[model samples]
Target: MIILTGVGDVKTAIESLKHGAHDFILKPVNVEELLIAAERALERRELLIERREYQVTLERRVEEATRDLDAAYTKLQDTYRATLEALGSALDTRDVGTQSHSRRVHGYSLSIARTHGVPGHQLEDLEQGVLLHDIGKIGIPDAILLKPGPLTPEEWKIMRTHPEIGKRLIERIPFLRGAVPVVWCHHERWDGTGYPRGLRREAIPLAARIFAVADAFDAMTFDRPYSRAISFAAARTEIHRCAATHFDPAVVATFLSIPESLFEDIRRRSLEP
Candidate 1:
């Protein structure tokens, strides 16, 4: 502020100064001093304008960078899922009679997890885990993996090692690291009788727990060479009966609560070409 007054005392000048007066000019103000004060104020105003513009530009740049990061993250996720799908498809072909089973199981597990209130970020890992749950079969001999009859005790021993094999296969991959638990522990029982590692109850990762129910449901409901397909109702009854023994009771409840129509829808979509 520039104060121009015809009469003023030291006290008034001090008060004006305190009130933010840039210049206090008495009557007969010098033209040169007035011009200098006006120039200084204009210069200060320009500096403030420039500062504001700079801040606005900086904010805009930050917003643009944030958007770019989000897009890149989305693309990376897509790539990861595509890779998992390709790997799953390859495994399915080798297993025989299980075509599209992984896809169906993926849908079921994701639904069960969402209904169970699993965090959004972990859902992707869960999906990947479900799709690749049998990845370790790659390490097994074709003779054992493709056997038409029930596996012998020796073959079963070799078969169970597939989970360990799967862990070794994926644990080193940075993106698949979160999914290792499901691959390694999907066969574990809620009663701690599960193989490889005896993780039981809450000691098991929630993703693996949710996956166990989904996998068993798919296996029971879908036809495989060794087993005839059962009705969804029958499968649900068996699943419910096994709660707290083969499946986590809480996860079983969540699975049972999911609308049957949704499960049918996921199954229908999974069969599409």
Candidate 2:
């Protein structure tokens, strides 16, 4: 701005300049001096406007670039999920009667986790962990993994290494690192009798504890080559009875609180093409 003032105090000129005045002039102004100051002030105003417009344009471009990056990230994440799902499906099909088991257990574990108050950000990790809980079975021999009857002690010992194997497999991937706990500890028992690490009670990660209940429940309620499927109520009763031994008591309670209908719905949806 250009300020024309009757007061010629040096302090007044300085103050006007300090208050964003481009030029300060006395009232007995020379027309040529006044015109020159006016031009300078107009130029300064134009420059300020241009700077503001440039900043706005720059911000708009940044926002657009950020949105594009976000879209690319989301697509990449979806592709990873699809690849993992295919791997999980492959693992499930390797067994004699466990087709869709990974998907069913994934849904069950996620529901129980949500009801148990798992944080929203961690749910993706939980889902990946549950779907790939048995991924280590890929390392097991077909003879033991697909045995029509009960496994012998030696076979059982070999089979129990799958959790560690799965852990090793998943931890190597940066994005899947969050899922390592569940893959490694899902077979662990609350009473410290489980395999690989024998993590007990609260020592076991909550995601692993949650998966234990869901996996056992799915096993009991689903038909296998060695056994027939039981009613959901019966499976729930069995799970409740085993709480604090085979499963986390708190996770068991949360799993029980979920409606049986929800489990059925998940199962039906998993079967969809």
Candidate 3:
């Protein structure tokens, strides 16, 4: 059956033809014939159907491509995370005392950062920085790194090169460029007395400042070659005493405010056999 469209008083002409007109055409149309017009309209309908089918096929292909791209992206992210974890693990293996140290520091740094209202994007960089803070230690000799006794002034001077080494290492990796400052400056003191570079106060990167407190707290609370683990309260007191001198005061305040249970949990997780 023909369907009439755009008709404007043209139905009268079709009606006058008296050939049981099934549809009408509007102005600017020739009213002299009807069969040829019907054929053309039918052909247009068929063409429209073919065009719609092509569009449906194109849309399906597009959706499939999008899904494939998403899957690839997810895989890439997973691979990158695995690589980072593996690199951290390798560094830990080189220094048995450092096993799980990076992870604990990362957790602590992230907690302090969150408490201090660091933006979400920067928090991610902080976490990574904390994990790799000691990466430069890889460059230190085993005699210096695992020495049972305190370092001599000369040896200490040599040991201080790790941060710069770590910064160099990370600079070579494009994905970790944002974390270079944290690696290089985590050892810097708030009072401008620390090694490598004497960056003081706000001049030090925030991530490094946050990491310093966390790293020191973890080191004091955990068993080390030179000393036994201290109680959490003792550690907290020591951390407070050093605020503004050894660490950023604001970071120390936040660190002190963290519940003891949180430190316990961190210690527990690190102690897992």
Candidate 2 — worst ten consecutive residues by lDDT sum? 127-136
lDDT per residue as tens, model 2, 65-174? 99999999999989988988898898889888888988899899889989999998789889889878888888999989878888999999999999999999989989
Give candidate 3 regions above 4 Å deviation. 1-64
lDDT of 1: 0.91
For all candidates, what are the clash counts?
Answer: 0, 0, 0
- The model with the greater TM-score, 1 or 2, is 2
Task: Extract clashing residue pairs from model 1.
Answer: none
lDDT of 2: 0.90
Winner on lDDT between 1 and 2 is 1
Model 2 clashing-pair count: 0
Which 10-residue span in candidate 3 carries the lowest summed lDDT? 1-10
Cα lDDT tens digits for candidate 1, 189-261? 9999997898889999999999999999999999999999999999999999999999999999999999888
Worst 10 residues of 1 by lDDT: 19-28
What are the models' TM-scores? 0.90, 0.95, 0.80
lDDT digits (tens) for residues 121-205 of candidate 3: 8986886777677789888999998887889999998899999999998999888987887899988999999978899999999
Candidate lDDT (C-alpha), each: 0.91, 0.90, 0.82
